[model samples]
Target: MARVSQEHLDARRRQILDGAAVCFARNGFHATSMQDVLKEVDLSAGAVYRYFSGKDALIAAIVGEVLDQVHEGFEEGARSTPPPPPDALLASVLSRVLATKESVTVDGRPAFPRLIVQVWTETLRNDELAAVLREGYGVVQRTWARIVEAYQDAGMMRPDVTPDHVARTMMASAMGFLAQQALFGPAPVEVLRDGLRGLMSVPDRGAGSQSG
Candidate 1:
């Protein structure tokens, strides 16, 4: 038998992952069986199992892949000259996320956001998945903290608040937006940008009083 090229093997693995993502997104994790994934990819059980041990393994890989993208986006921004302001940085990431999810949507509903929400719920019972998520998000958060520190140094953000705290809060806001988008229909990305701008515009009462 001719040896399978590494490129071909990688492509097959990607196919399995993409198919599993769609199935899990269309139907909840519990509802999507391994057979459903095999059917979606039109691959035999042996072929699919060779890539992922089972549904849980697929779920973990899918979630890790998505989170890794998000982490990379933040890392990229940090490398830019004067890195994007917080709002623009976040808006860019959100736009990419929406577009990617929209590409694999089912019945006009984006699969990626839905799958994200499902993963959050799944983490409640699955300690292993929860650990994976925590570590992934933790790295993203650290990157954001570094960005926050830069903002503080440039006087764009207040220096009083801890960078980690600001980063975590920003992450929470972003997650809330995703949950809202998933539960309801899609909203313009402007909504998120405007909201962040409005928050940034708010005066710091402590600073105002001390300066008076």
Candidate 2:
């Protein structure tokens, strides 16, 4: 048999992943099956199985792609002349995420955002997925911590708090944005950026100031 070129193999893998994404986004994880994926891609069972063993594996691959992209954004930000502020960095991250072709379903609904809600719920019962999620987030957290340190070095952020603490809080906010996007249709990324700015801009009341 003639050997398949690497480019051909890569394209096939992309086809499977993209088709599975549409299926999962439309019907959800539990509702989507390997057979459903095969029908969506119009590929033979053997061909599709060559890439993903089952729906669990497909779901894991999709989630991994999303996390990997988020991680890459932080890596890029770290190398800039000055790293983006937490809010702006997150807004950029979300913009890239929402702009991906795979992020939208055929019906014009957000794909990854909906899948993310399912992934979070799946973590409770899927140990492998839970571990994958924890590992992915840990790497992202470390990347953000380095940015936090840079901010501290420039006196842009307070030195009193640990970098991990700030990183965790920022990540929590990003996750919250995804949750909201998943549940409530798309909102402008600026809303999140501006809201964070508003929170950070609040004037601090001096201890001496009090009601008479």
Off by over 4 Å in 1: 205-207, 210-212
How far is 105's C-alpha from truth in model 1 (Å)?
A: 1.7
Candidate 2 global lDDT = 0.86
Per-residue lDDT over 1-212 for candidate 1, one digit per residue giving the tens place of the 0 to 100 score: 99999999998998898788788878888889998999999999999988889999998998888898889888988777567888889988878767765667667677777778889999999999999999999999999999988887778777888999989987987899989878997787789888998988887777756753
Where model 2 places Cα greater than 4 Å from the true spot, the runs are: 1-3, 206-212
Which candidate number has the best TM-score?
Answer: 1
- Checking candidate 1 for backbone clashes, the offending pairs are none
Each model's lDDT: 0.86, 0.86
Q: Give model 1 RMSD, 1 decimal.
A: 2.3
The TM-score obtained by model 2 is 0.89
What's the lDDT of the predicted structure labeled candidate 1?
0.86
Model 1 Cα displacement at 136 (Å)? Answer: 0.7
TM-score for each model: 0.91, 0.89
Cα misplacement distance, residue 114 of candidate 1 (Å): 0.6
Candidate 2 per-residue C-alpha lDDT over 58-146 given as tens digits, one digit per residue, 9 for 90 to 100:
88898899899999999998877568888899899878877885444757876777778888988998999999999999999999999
